[model samples]
Target: MVLSYEPSVKSRIMVCITPQKSSRRLVERGAQRAKETNGEFCVVYVNKNSDISQDLKENEVLLELFDMAQKLGGRVSILVGKKISKTLAEFARENNITEIIVGKSLRSALDVILHGDVVNPLKKEAMKNNIRVEVIE
Candidate 1:
């Protein structure tokens, strides 16, 4: 008996988006990397319930991200959660994401004091899952 099997291919790349200017850069870079690697591109945006003001700003950015992802032949997700970094990591693991592209935080002092920085924990979590994380400053 001869069996021909197909190799397993799970090459999905995800980008973490926020309302900062760097998000645009991150999406562009993530798309380029995905294209170069012949991988699927995805975008993840974490939404926090505490900030009503943030919601409006983030919505605008989210729309741009969606458009960007669509143009790149990819998908985008907006997750509502308290822990931004943790949520993104979980999404990556669940979606079989190989790489995560995130932009440096533009969080205000009050926001940082309230919620903490996202990039550090995100990197740690990604490392634990063996997911490559790229931080764009």
Candidate 2:
């Protein structure tokens, strides 16, 4: 019996999004990349416990992401986990994602202290997983 082999090249990328306006830019970029590479796309969102509701019609952010994915011609997935970076990276690996799209954060002392848990760990783990992470400045 002959076996067909599939390449491991990452055709799909996962982008982490929040309520921030920059997410729109990332979505656009992800869409372009997906189109150029002829690869499927997926979007991941991490929100707080109280933020989620069963109303996409009323939830603008969720709706926006879905719309972008649809327009970009890719698949979309939303994840509700507290750990942002860890969850994102795990998702990329799980879905055989090769790249990640993220927006750059304005540097602030308070922001660093608070978000170090997510940013620092994410950078290190992405390298370990052999995933390419793109931070839009």
Candidate 3:
């Protein structure tokens, strides 16, 4: 119903979704946790630059995930950026998110070496903003 956007509002949980199977589980866990706390939940997808086909496929996945989130009484949002962790942190700050739910890292070795892992950075950023970050298995 009335989802308060204030930083001091009641618990607000944010679920970060990717094109991984674990994302679905993470969303479900986030929604259940939110319900347990009598709070609200939202799902977010970060899009990096990619080819048209890839983007289309990602959009399809996002739509499906959005439906899942909606069925669980959660909202969905999309954010486009070069740096996912930074974008997510900015979004969390702007939205006054109290908690963040993220799946385990799905990055390859090279990707990890090149861009680093999102989970650690997200956790650090969330800590600075006084938000809690939970990594779902």
Among the numbered candidates, top lDDT falls to 3
**Stretch of 10 with least lDDT, candidate 2:** 1-10
- Residue range with the least summed lDDT across 10 consecutive positions in model 1: 1-10
- Candidates in order, TM-scores: namely 0.80, 0.80, 0.85
Can you give the lDDT of residue 37 in candidate 2? Answer: 72
State the lDDT of candidate 1 residue by residue for 1-137, as single tens digits. Answer: 11111236456788888765557888888889877887777777777775655776647766776787789776777787888888888888777678998887777889988979888898999999899988888
Q: Is candidate 2 or candidate 3 better by TM-score?
A: 3
71-103: candidate 2 lDDT, tens digit per residue: 777566666667777777777766677778887
- lDDT, candidates in the order shown: 0.77, 0.70, 0.83
Candidate 3 Cα lDDT to native: 0.83
So what's the TM-score on candidate 3?
0.85
Tell me which residue pairs clash in candidate 2: none
The residue pairs found clashing in candidate 1 are none
* Top candidate by TM-score: 3
Candidate 3 off by > 4 Å: 1-9, 50-54, 57-59
